[model samples]
Target: MKLIFLGPPGAGKGTIASRISKDLNIPHISTGDLFRKAIKNQTELGKKVQQIIESGDLVPDALTVALVKERLNNPDVENGYILDGFPRTIKQADSLESFSKIDNVINFVISDEQVIQRLSGRRMCKNCGEGYHIENMKPQKEGICDKCGEELIIRPDDTPEAIKNRLAVYYESTAPLIDYYKEKGLLLDIDGAQEVGKVAEATSKAISK
Candidate 1:
């Protein structure tokens, strides 16, 4: 399908993409995972990425584009792949268009208030790193991990202020890609406020056409 999934954090792009990838037998390619894999493997690009990340600087777009270009060369992507987090800017989108034909860009739409509420409610287990939500997926006991009986703590980045900051950054950088793809007639909007199952169903129906 050569798809791109776009949405703010907590919009369930990753979860829905995973489901759609399995249903269609296509790989779900996330740029974040690519960076981690590259760094873990200690590739040449990985070395540069590690240095950049260690210095706490955002990775430059050129390097990011190169990494995506390299990944697209892999054979598994021959059939198709769902790109979860790439082309975060118009320049990156242009770079992608230069190398590949994207079939669709699914833009999951949710309000900032909903995003903040969803993210701020997230809790992670201290011991096993399992995830839970205060509202959506509560554990058997309050503030505890069901699997490991560990204390569940709110992630620092999941705080309301932090989520608002992230949304600001997203609006500044990635949000324009929505309009960019829409102009190209390749954008599909999906309501992200729905239940995960319903969202997945809507996404599947959107792509199936």
Candidate 2:
């Protein structure tokens, strides 16, 4: 299934995309993962992305599109892949049409208050990077990672102020894609406030249709 997952940060796009990808036996391609892999391997594109990120600027559409296209060329994506962070703009969405056709776009809907609650309660292990949610998925120890036994910390970006800023940017930049895909009859809206498993089931039903 050639699918695209659209959601704001803390909207659980990553989790839902992963579940769908695994069930469908397709690769789950995320822009963030691609950038991290490139940077870790120190590829030519990685160097440029590093510079752009260090300068506190967004990666240009051309560069982001190029990276996505490169990833789409992988053997695993031969059948199809689930895309999670590319095409945040109308231009990028148009650009993707040139190379591949998307079958569906799953849009996870959540309120700002829910996002703040979900993200603000998130804690990550400083040593192992394991994540824990205070209310939903707490760690065994009070504030320690289960696997590594290290203290967990709330990332600065997980703060309410930062989450609100991110939401503002997302609405300003990515909200239009909703209507764009809806017009194409490829948008599938799912209530993200539901439990994770329920959301996944709903996503599966949406894709089946």
Candidate 3:
């Protein structure tokens, strides 16, 4: 089933999206992953995105839309895909509606304080890049990676201010998609503060409708 997950940063949208995509056999496409690949390849779009990313500003809609369109047109997405990001603005959402039929819009609702705690505690292994949520998904040993012995460090983007800014942008830019999807009878708000497995179950139940 095609799906779009909407939520602020640290709201567990990615976690839920991954679960839904895996359990339902749908591709999980995320804009952040696309941009990271672009930056790694140092493509023209990557250079542009890297600049904006380093400046700690939102990637403009035009670039984001182009990137998203490229991803949506991929062969793997032909059957169905879980969109974890993109359509962060009215224009983009309107644009997507032109060609896409959103089966469901899963909105994960979480408080800002919880988001901060979730994000601030996040750390990743520099060697293996394995992610660990300090509290929710802790490493086997304190300040150490489970897979690699390297110490886990938080990326610069995971700062409290950046996380808060991302939430602000989500509320201002992406939250409206809630109404847009609701009008289409495709919006489902899921409580993100719950356990991951519970969240996944609730999401599946909602989308089954």
Candidate 4:
């Protein structure tokens, strides 16, 4: 199942993508993770990405496209893979289409208000990086990480103001992909306001059909 998971910040696309990837036995390919791994390994591509990042400039689309192409060629993607954060633009989508055809594009739908609330309430473990929300998903102990017994902190970008800005940027940059895939007859919309399990079930059914 070559799939594209698209959504704004706090839409739970990553969680849903991880679940679907596990269920289908396909690798979950996230561009951020790929960049981090490449940089950590200090490969040739990693050096170029590092230089671009250190210069505080966005990596050029050609480099990004090349990196993704190299990743997709890995053996783990032979069956398929779940794309979490690629094709953020129509141009990138065009680049991807040149190499591979996506079977389904899951567009997660959630309101801007809900996105702000969900992100603002989220906290992460400083030591182990586990995530928890102040309301929806809480840790065993107050203000502490259940896994690593470390302090939990709200990320700076998770604040209401920052989240609102993120939502605006997402709408501006990534929302167009919804229509792009819809026109291609590969878009499947799923309500992201529901409980996690319910959303997962709906997504599974939507893609199955």
lDDT of 2 by residue, 100-208 (tens): 9999999999998899999999999999899999999999989999999999999989988898899998998899999999999999999999999999999999888
TM-score per prediction, in order, is: 0.98, 0.95, 0.86, 0.94
lDDT of 3 by residue, 1-209 (tens): 77888888888888888888888887898988989988999988889999999999979888887777777888888778998887788898877877677777888998999889988999999999999987888898988998869999998879987887888878898888889889888888999999889999998998887
- Which candidate leads in TM-score? 1
Evaluation by lDDT, superior candidate among 1 and 2:
1
Runs in model 2 deviating more than 4 A are none
Order of candidate numbers by lDDT, starting with the best: 1, 2, 4, 3
lDDT of each: 0.94, 0.92, 0.86, 0.91
lDDT by residue for model 4 (47-118), tens? 999999999998877888889999999998988989998888888999999999899999999998888888
List of clashing residue pairs for candidate 3: none
- TM-score-superior candidate, 1 or 3: 1
Count of clashing pairs, candidate 2: 0
Error of 2 at 82 (Å): 0.7
Rank by TM-score, descending? 1, 2, 4, 3
Decide which is better by lDDT, 3 or 4: 4
- The better-scoring model by TM-score among 2 and 4 is 2
lDDT of 4: 0.91
